[model samples]
Target: MTAQAARHHAEGRLAEAVTAYTDALRLDRRNPALLSGFGLVLRDLGQIDGAATCFEAAFALDPGCVDAADSLGTLRAGQGRFAEAEACHRAALVHCADRAPFWNNLANALSRQGRAAAALAAWRRAVLLDPALPEALSNLGGGLCDAERLDEAERTHRRALRLMPDEPQANNNFGHALQARLRHAEAARWFRRALALDPGYAAALCNLGLAVQRLGDGTLAERLYGRALRATPDLPLARFNRGLLRLERGDLAEGWAGYGWRFASGQAGGTRPPRLPAWRGEDLAGKRLLVWGEQGVGDTILFSSLCGEAIARARSVVIETDRRLVPLFARSFPAALVRPHGPGAAAVPDCDLHTPIGSLARVFRRDLSAFPGPAGGWLVPDPARVALWRERVATLGPGLRVGIGWRSALVTESRRAAYSRLDQWGALFAVPGVVFVTLQHGACEAERVAAEDLFGVAIHRWDDLDLTDDFDGTAALMANLDLVIAPATAVGELAAALGVPVWRFGGRDWTQLGTAVRPWFPAQRLFQPQGGEDTPGVLRRMAGQLDSRLI
Candidate 1:
């Protein structure tokens, strides 16, 4: 009967195997081999609890049942119980210390727990134990990629692919390694290979969408996200990426709904435990609500536009924002208590509900109609400092004061194209009767000097003002400017928020909320390189506009 049950399972007759195993187990309840075999049948049938019970019984019946323990450990790993899975795998490894699969299992659990160094060592040991093990090789390649040993990762992944040519996961993982190296086109091909192997593979579909997104096809990327969601409805990554697409295109309705999936998709901002339940668009009537800042400084400023709406609805509001923005925010929202966030955050009064600043859009800015503002922007700058800058700017002679930020301080590989080089701003600088001032943050003295030498136009910079840390000072200075020209970065956002006329550029800003201008700031105008137009061409066009419109 046991042999028949094993034969049924081996032939892929899972239902028949389950029945055979039940009949065999009824005959010999104390038999560890029978119990262990029964556990496999149950596990394959999706009866996880029953399978666990069978494995436990088998191990109890015979303490030497390493297979039963290993099976149980795999079940634990599948349930997202990594620590328990690690414990179970370790127990199995004690008796079967030489087993490559046991080490691989242990390594997988450790990897999930974010113990990268230990996981790498375990994967190496597993590969050393059995150099031909495809799973170990694939996992080791991923570890190498995480450690940024791209060359080693590519070699390891190539070997894994050679060993398991038909494995979709191996192909997908190799594509991930390529994507990490910014080889999106090559990565897309590997993702396609993975998709060809398994049409319903959700992960590969999401990865393919990311590659397409990097190639600048937001429409196709969104469609791929839809496909991935269709493949796996609960996939957080697809949902999160789709949300970003919708938001960027000014589809606030669906975008905000999808944006909430960011935390679940393993995007940052979930590090600190919540003191209160997440506020999911619930009515704040009489409820003390906390709106916390997230993402970057620009994001915090942009999202704070919705804080006014939050204040109107909630009984009281406590805003926790970037430390530098505290003074500016405190003056802007005088009704609410404003505090700086991050380590050593000041004592915030208890709140009934809490939400990240980004999440406020899902409730307040559901549509363009929800974005009605007082105009001139929401944030307020210090009147005294504004007067101080006004006097200082008067000394620069009779010309339109234009603050310029050429690039962001936090430019990553993906964001490289979003910002322009200092030389690209030469066309705008060459415009007559324009006093170009440096609002460019971080260290850019070389670029400033080079710009002056290249274009023979001086970009006036303040030696006293700290552009990076002093937001209140920056706000005051920006308030005195006649106009601000920059990318879709902090300077643009801040100037616009201060009600200063800003000519902002870069790409399709989703913050426009599907309009000709940014709804969050009525004082701003957007510019982008149309068709095949490059950065300098766009800047030249902007100069023409400045001459006719403002000069």
Candidate 2:
């Protein structure tokens, strides 16, 4: 009977194996080996609880049954009980320390518990025991990448590929390593290869879309995302990428729906634990609502525009925002309670409902026509700080007072191309009556020196102000400027929020939606490069516009 059951399992007839195993177990109920075999067949049939019982009985009957312990560990790991899984794996290893599969299973449990170092060690041991284990090699490569050891990760992934050339996951992971190094074209080829091996590979398809997007081919990227979605409709990555693409093309309805997938896709940063129910455009007439910030500082500023609408609907609103913006938000929305994110967040009064700041767009600005027009500015800078900067600007000899920020905090190749080089701003610097004030934050001393030498203009710098940490001070300085020219960084968003005249530069980013102007900021004008034109051409066009306005 056991031989027949084993033959059925080997032939992939799981139901027949389960039936045969049950008959054998009934005949010899005390046999630990029979119970362990039955447990494995039950597990394959997805009867987790039944399988667990059989494994437990087998272990109790004979504690030396390493297979039973290993099987139990795998079952517990699948159930998200990592501690129990670890104990089972440890017990199994005591009996068979050299078993590569047991070590790999232990590594999986450790990885799930966020013990990266321990997981990596176990994976190394497993690979050392069985050098031909492709899965262990692939996992080890991923762990190396997580630790930022890119060179080792690349080599390990290549080794895995050499062992199993058609392994979909190994190919996908190798592409990810290349993508991290910004080698998008090479990464795209690997992703294509993965798709060739497994046509319905959703993750590979989505990654291919991202690579194509970085290559400045949004159209192809959109099609690739579509293919991914067709393969796996519930894939969050494909949905999220498709959403951004649709929004960039001005398809608001579908775009906003896709945008809702951000939280599930792990793209949103600083997400708080879900304590209160999410508001789905429901009535908040008498409810205390919490609108917490998600994503970057720039997104917080841009989306804060919708607070007024929420304030009008809700009885009382509590806004949880970045600490730097707390004072600004408190003053801006006097009717609501503004609290800084982290530590003291729990001290705030409980709310009837909560919503993410970005989610407000889904409710209020679903259509382009639904967007609010210039309500002057929602954020108000300190009048005292404004006056201080106003007096300081008098030392610059009284020109047009144009503030310039030529870089974003993100220094990726695509972002750099969108922002342009400091030397490319020569045309704008040559404008007759313009004096450039440096609003750029971070390490820009070298860029500033190069720009001054290359463009023959003094780009003024203020060492006293910490632009990165002191956004309040930055806003005050921006309020006193005649105009600010920047990329789609937080600087542009901040200046526009303060009602400063901002000429913002960007490529085909979703935020602007390929429009001449964005509905979120009336004080800003969008400057896009002409067909096949580089940053120099865009700057020249901006210089012409500045010349017309100043003259």
Candidate 3:
């Protein structure tokens, strides 16, 4: 209330203003104006505790003070005392129910309590009271995002930006909503705007990192994530993004350890639902470990290679794999127990160590040279299935039986995106004295029709020989083939595990193991893209390799 204190506060000299206000408050302890002025100066100076004390004293002197109550509630929210903040907001609302800022504060307090529906309703009321409440609209968008209503969330955020074009929080929130909708390009644009507004905005930087990662720029993503970490070290999203980048670059040892932070982050790319607890650097020696399968059946088949190595160290190993694979894997690993997949009467016993099938490779994996070629075939053919497959192969023809598969696995986004073009198989079928047999499963109707059109009688499509639908049947048929040529897939792995001669056709930038001949499977050879539109050329080369070796 003093002229000197007011002048200092107006000049943005908050520390000086606080000292002058404190002296004036000391002179007249009962003056509400002096106490409230001191509290505002203290709050600006970041002395939250002192500010709260001053606000409470001012409110005691004048019981109907709105600013004092609002400041006190904000301090409580900062301290993470949501219940106390809610009480303060509600009391302030009783005095001034129609105030837009008070309603926004109340909604924020409700949101902190995890009452998202009530928070949304309060935010709607706040916006109705003041249409220009950009912060309120942004908060509403956040609530909608929490509810997983991404489209509406995007619209709300855009509306906020339209009202306050340069609002930092609005830009950040809009970017986040766009990213949620998988609009990576647009999200990157909004995130850049947010960064331009405030260069050290940690959340915006982290979101930009994720968007760029989706755009397939891992190096830039890593740099952005690192910058976010420097700005806010405790941001779990940035930490998890850094971990994923490391994992993608094949730094599995540190990657798995950094990946443990996903549990702490409530991000979308965090760990999927697991049937068993994830292995957390727990000592597995002398402990019964249940390695439960997650994701698709082929992933289970690919990961099963690690079971033998893991079982060597553990007291006992119990594998809970896909039901279709039980007959095959059980025969291969007689030492370890096998349980069929899905719900059963069997109680999941409390095991000292449990790991998802995917994580096993990280712990007990070897380099390409050291890969222990699974003896014989882990996926054994059933007698009846073999009989059925033999009948189908005989019906196809008398030419050199060349098994051809083009599609990759179709479980996760990564797998679905890794398919080999069908034209890649055309040149191999065009080769002399070779018959193209369709070995792929989950081929689209369009792909199947196209295969028939391209290869004619040389291409055989048997509905009964689906690798995904019946693994045992496919294994039996693969066992009878002269040569198996396919994309770097689970079936390719399975064929090699069977010790059958296979030529793997790879994408231009495929797995490193697929680029070179795998020593683990001496029976296998790799034919990668020589560069551009040359899948046909890769296939022609593989046909030559097969003609020289097998013919």
Checking candidate 3 for backbone clashes, the offending pairs are none
TM-score of each: 0.79, 0.83, 0.61
Per-residue accuracy of model 1 over 427-511 as CA lDDT, tens digit each: 7877788998899998889999998999899889889999999889999899888899999789988998888888887777567
**Top model number, TM-score:** 2
Q: What order do you get sorting by TM-score, best first?
A: 2, 1, 3
RMSD of each: 4.6, 4.1, 8.7
State residue 324's C-alpha deviation in candidate 2, in Å: 1.3
Candidate 2, number of clashes: 0
Query: Please, what are the lDDT tens digits per residue for candidate 3 over residues 1-551?
Result: 48899889989998789789878878888887778778888888888888899888877778688778877998899887988888888877888889999889989999877688999999989999998899999998988887777778878888899998887778999988877777889999999999999999999999999899888898899899989999999888788777767766655565555554554565322123334565654677888888777655655676787788778888898887777777777877777888775556125664656776767755764334455554554455667767877887787767788777777645332343345677556555666777666777764557767767877744666665565767777778887788887776777877776666777776533124332544445556767666454666666787677667546
lDDT of each: 0.87, 0.88, 0.74
Task: Show model 2 residue runs off by greater than 4 Å.
Answer: 1-7, 20-40, 48-132, 139-155, 176-189, 209-227, 343-349, 413-416, 421-432, 449-457
Full candidate order by lDDT, most accurate first:
2, 1, 3
Model 3 alpha-carbon drift over 4 Å, by segment: 1-189, 198-207, 210-220, 230-240, 248-250, 259-283, 343-347, 366-370, 373-378, 408-417, 420-425, 443-446, 465-467, 483-485, 488-490, 496-551
Model 1: runs farther than 4 Å from truth? Answer: 1-159, 177-186, 210-223, 248-250, 268-273, 342-349, 391-398, 443-446, 449-457, 547-551
Candidate 3 TM-score to native:
0.61
Residue 363, candidate 1: Cα error in Å is 1.3
